[model samples]
Target: MAFPRSTCLLLLLASFLLTPLEGHTFNVMDYGAIGNGRTDDSEAFMKAWSDVCKASASPTFLVPGDRRFLINPVVFEGRCRSKKIKFKVDGTITAPSEPSKWKCINKQCHSWISFKHVDGLVISGSGTIDGNAEKWWKQGRVTGARPNALVVARSNNVQLHDLSFKDNPHMHVVFHHCDGVKISHISIDAPEDSPNTDGIHLKETASVIIEHCTIGTGDDCISLVDGSTHIDMRHIKCGPGHGISIGSLGKFGLSETVEYIHVKDAQFTGTTNGVRIKTWQGGRGHARNMIFEKIRSSDSEYPIIIDQFYCDHTECHDKPNAVEIRNISYIDVKGTSKKETAVKIACSDTVPCRDIFIQNINLIYDQSGKQASAYCKNVINGYYHGVVRPNISCLQNDKLP
Candidate 1:
């Protein structure tokens, strides 16, 4: 059989086009990204993400092991074609040490790596995201101009595990407006004096579960802000930071609500506070149906505190409206408090906290040798059980004056 050259070429092209498209692994090194730790690999990363984002099948974007990648501020934004994508970071990702080089003009630019509008994204790696923050810390001012190591915003069905973040300039990881996020087996470390270096911060997010994580940072180990709901945290070890907190919320005097939060089986060592809920004096909304149980604290201050009048500066004055807090419970919380007053429930006089329950709580001051005490005001329907310190006499008999 003799075939003409043009006909043979057409048949070959048809055969190639009919072949099935296979999944690919886009390596950053293949796209002109030198993993020498000094060269800027931002463009390579962007190109890799673009290729993987358009993959028809589930593909992997890999950062190979044993190499260090220096990436400036980059955003991996997507309405990706793939239904699922895997990002395997097997090497170190380092940020620029100099703050001036960051050139961050606004808050959005203050993130080293950001993922937006990504769905079904799995980020797991045995690698490190190093935010060489010692130089920024020396500048001595915690500003929004500094970049956070990672930010996952407007994303859904995200799972991040087995990763490490160190020396972050700001909060290590932030989940903003994200849903169905699960994070486990992660480690975050920062100096105790690294200002505003919160470990994990959630805002406007829902259905998040964070477990089996060890976090040590300067600010709150875990902070849930406005519009966050159904958050569960378990088996977390926190140290040298402000402990788990909710509702440093409504700061702008806006209407905000945080509900259905449960934090159990957690331990805090040398933290400033444990299981705290703080809100500004003039705010609207509610913090309800929250539980903190089986918490073991060591050398912590204000082991259980609800401050409706949370003003950080001297110029802030008391306001009338406050966030309504109700149906909150703290059970089996035993700790050594650094302050003499272990329990302070300073609720708002206007709205007042209701349906508060405390059980099996035993907090003792370590150094003072004085017994820990409880202070309550403008609270009602309070119940105490099993060795309550400082005597919840003020809250006895549902008394409201």
Candidate 2:
């Protein structure tokens, strides 16, 4: 019974005061030259993100190097319980092509990087957040007003890395109702005839992990905004734009139920199609167990699509009765099309698209550059066999047949 060296130094000082270190790295150009590039320096980078995101730390917040800063939507106020704000951008944070210099103070602006009720946030860097956005997409082509780039609400354990975004007036990135999120080695772009440039927009998110990204857009290079679920998309390099979708949900009847997803080794170019899922027409719920592997396509259209009566805008005056797609699968999806006609599936009239699967795929379409046809109302089952468009016969609406 040999105790007492001052009671073992008071139990080693109570385990070093309840062990918790590593969280704090701040350096906005060493707090000077204030990130030049026409600086407001966003109140000295929100006072170094409220001083090391509530110090007690050693990791996160080092937007280093050749700076060119300007930001808005900057309400990164602290008290995140822990995990601390970690933004390690090594240069280039440009985002003020005058959205009225990010006006706020009750105009309710937020997002050039945002987070609500934060969690262990860690935005990585190979540096570049440039939303120069070609004069706000030329004023959204006469003031349509597009907007969205790096927004994470109702936060969770979020992590972004090796960044690079270009010309984004809208939907370059957004994850609302966030859960465990992780996006990697990014490279995004716009101008596939830029309209509503989308590339990674997962609203009402759950568990997500989008990897090795590269998207170019006008729309839907990842638009599943409506109560998402555990998603895992890999090696994606989607298109000139639009593909990899699962929605276009109707109004606010929002009951979205997308299932466990796994899209692998992807690649699509000039894409208007290739693994798509659209829903509207009095939308209720249900998008089941999904899986698309080894996907590859070019000059796409019907590269693999599913439309549950998705009517882009206006024209879906509520028409769902038998809606509910199930266990979907596409394997060995290979590319090289664009003379047109590869694969397209459309459904409704009582929700036609049902349990489907495509195997050992190889699609190459082009009978006259741009092929896609399908208008199957209440689509049932299919083992789909390819090749159409050589003196076309039935390639259906949105048109070619």
- 171-210 in candidate 2: lDDT tens per residue? 8788888899999888888788777778888877888999
* Number of the top-ranking candidate, with TM-score as the measure: 1
Those runs of model 1 whose alpha carbons end farther than 4 Å from true positions after fitting are 1-23, 103-108, 140-144, 367-370, 397-401
Each model's TM-score, in the order given?
Answer: 0.92, 0.34
Summed over model 2, clashes come to 17
| Model 1, span 116-229: residue lDDT tens | 998989998999999998888888664446677899999999999999999988889999999999999999999999988999999999999999999999999999999899
**lDDT per model, in order?**
0.88, 0.71
Report the poorest 10 consecutive residues by lDDT, candidate 1.
Answer: 392-401
